[model samples]
Target: MNESESHGHIPAPLGSVEPHAPLLSVPSDGQLLYKISSVENLLRSIVGNYLHFNRVDSYADFPGADPHDGRQLPKDQQGNSLARFEKSPDFSAANYYDQSRARTYACCFSLENSDFIWKNYANGSEKGKVGVVFEFGRLRTMLNQTLQPGNAALKYNGNQCDQIFSVNYGIVEYVDWDTHQANVDHLQNPIRYTYLKDKERFSEEKELRISLSAMGIGQFALKDGSMMQFPSSLQLAFDFKAAIADGAIQQILYASDSDSDFLQAELHKLRIVSSKG
Candidate 1:
């Protein structure tokens, strides 16, 4: 058998990130739960929505199966020996398969916090923060848009009830292997895609109305450990976003660098709020 045949892997779709293999050993501290919980809480706080975490596991029949390693699967179908040996068909298209058949990992999810962030804040830099604040009706608009049959909601419906009826019992007519497979990736991944798409609608280029000096801070530190007082000639990066249902901020790092000339840095989301009139 060829080297690819000896290993078990399937080609990933273009632009999609590679999946990671199951951990051989159990995680030691279970701190992953805590780290994930913090993110969930941040999400909840930002968007008044809840976040949930779920994991899937799989084993690697060959090397380079770890998700973080970034070793992409060979394009040829030779890498999936387990499937070939079992007389299974190739799985290049997007669908759900077992762990024994291919590498697997968990996918955590929550509502699109970027929606809340963007709509709450005006399209430009207000005061000192440099991100959108979701509008009052934006979440409602997003939910209405999402649930409009054949949209992302139908994909997440698990039963495909809505999708099936859209074309006169189309979903029921095609529930089997010949028709479709139950894959949650589309539903789970759309949050980021939706966020990016929404971001494109806003033109925040010239609306920034705040100065770096106006941001409240006694001291700041650079990655190089350089320290400086506030309100100096040096520039600052600013970012802000709404919390998810679980009260956690969406992944920060959405703003651009303030200093275009001499310095460069992305701003970290600040958890603490300061009050100064």
Candidate 2:
């Protein structure tokens, strides 16, 4: 057995940033109840609508997983040990998320406040703060197209009735199994991050408008000969939600240093605002 298998856990090697795990959940308010049928309708209403991803405040993204430790989990048919998130392949994938690529995409999510994601990604360690789950309709569209994939192509009706889908979350790590350290050393630091005169200063905003360029080529190579890719960046808007107790949200916006320079640091502090602001 491998050393990790012998010990029954994987340790986060030193110098690696925190692990990136998104929250998952379902609702429990007594005011509303969902039948399998009704949930389908509600989802259908927005089948073609767009959901947004936001830049996460990684340090603030806790009340979450233990970065240094690992858990004992089940294995897949191929002998790949399954993390809790990958156990329910269909159900979990539909509501998944990850923020590790924020260095380039300048976007990530948390379950700190999102109860819905917390319940679904319900391993004791997986806590999500991003209250809402943006369910992707599985309707792949090309750029500037008003069209959605035909219904036959979506995760709707028939056998796919209860199966919603999302690739927003990350579970598989980009590390070495033996060392459990980042497989690629340089990629750990976002290229744009170097431009900051003050790594701590962020910005202020309610809704965010991310352009296509803010996200770099969006793909990087790992030491293991595999490529790491972020979810394609979409033109999304973060309409201010009512403020919660977290002080003004000082987030990092990872766009190109400017519209003109995708190579420099566009990473900075962004103070998120509420409608009340």
Candidate 3:
């Protein structure tokens, strides 16, 4: 089936807006998103027909990434207040803000197919790099269908815990945190932070983020001698072979002519074809 036939019908893209509008907005279904990575990673994803999300905290090595990317506490619990809580006798700040327990796994993509993205993400590797193009609507459809509702048992501080799984995708918002304030309620909805980035990254990366979040309902003690139920983290992967069959993937841009030949052969071996072809 064709693109429109696959997604039912395409919607108009959400145009540019002021900072901190709704955190999630859908682009035009026909819009192409690019994922640049090492050829090995691309090949693995293609051959396995799966997308893998690394724990959000493990992105410390990414350029211009915040050191505390996935570890931010709620607004009321930040800065000087956090210092005071750290010294509190009744409050165990570590347990209360146990980022490890509330895990977020993410895979990133770019709306722009620029040289900057190519150099930063796909360059400087002996193995070379490649960019995979995905159609927005089909990808969204695949992710929605692939989303599985399940429960997980977790252990934190020797206590048994349970978490529920959820998935989200959207355009990443670039913010000048020095000036722009995020209107999100981090205490109740921390997963929204996954779609935020510093303005320094705005020019280079127009990002689209897909995140899988697993949060538990365990209660933790606050510095005020009160308890609040918070989310614990989990990680997961999803198979997209069916979406591929429906033409979610648009094209593969290889680093070289030789790489193109290699990909054509590899894709042929996997029995994959672009909808355009």
Candidate 4:
């Protein structure tokens, strides 16, 4: 086993930064994180040895999802909006460039095994839904390796683009965006915003998020002589076989014995064990 595996905690990698310094702590190896989804989705992940991450923008379509997910601007101490520069065309273009280059793709897990997750996320259907538990340490290590610099790449306009990759994982913080004040400098780090959610989501979700970002370096000249960059791919598929080999998956929870039996047979085909919830 490697040092990280033995230690049960993940160290932030090259491009990962803690903008919310004191509040976020890496979860321990034994910490159980739950992901509730359809049985088909859960089986697909296990059979494919990968997890799919959707662009931050895609999440805006979810019910009760924060509208300002990735576009939230920092507020000054006096509660003033510090986005006055957004009105300028030049600044707007630049902002769009930055936002596109640093676009975040994320997958969510919950720190709790609440009925709310089963009801909303798993559709509350015993035959079609299930929850999977993962060990944080192994999951983090797998993500760090899968997102390492050259393991993934971005393309724009049919051309390969130079990019810097980063991966971050942490417990999400529920905050009232209107009342929260962030350092102006926080805007420079896109992953930081993924950790913050509306306070209304706190009680039931208790979310843990894994976010991946790529900052594009290659640029194209706009008609106005300004430079802009964008990514063509808005999603990422990361392999988790290594984590599974490390016993990252703890258990598969099913609502009924019949469901458990079906899962066991399916999992047995993949050499994975299944248990009743």
* Local accuracy of candidate 4 as per-residue lDDT tens digits, 112-216: 888878777755345577787888877776666655665654444565543344666778777777777555444334445667677765547888887666542
Error of 4 at 274 (Å): 3.3
- Per-residue alpha-carbon lDDT of model 1 for 154-184, expressed as tens digits? 1221222122111000000111222222232
lDDT of 2 at 250: 27
lDDT: which candidate is best? Answer: 4
Model 1 residue 102 lDDT? 24
Model 4 RMSD to the real structure? 9.3
Give the range where candidate 2 is weakest over 10 consecutive residues by summed lDDT: 69-78
- Candidate 4 regions exceeding 4 Å error are 1-24, 60-62, 73-89, 92-102, 124-126, 150-163, 184-188, 216-242, 256-258, 275-277
Model 3, range 1-277, lDDT digits (tens) per residue? 0122112222212211112225576578888999988776667776665676766766666565555455443442443123323233333333333442255667788998988777777555556788878898888776665453333333344564333335677787776645544433323245556666666755478888777654322334334445433332232344546656676877777766226566667767877654453
Where does candidate 3 stray beyond 4 Å?
1-23, 62-66, 71-102, 150-163, 183-188, 216-241, 273-277
Candidate 3 achieves a global lDDT of 0.57
Reference-based lDDT, residue 238, model 4: 47
Scored against the true structure, residue 43 in model 1 reaches a CA lDDT of 31
Worst 10 residues of 4 by lDDT: 1-10
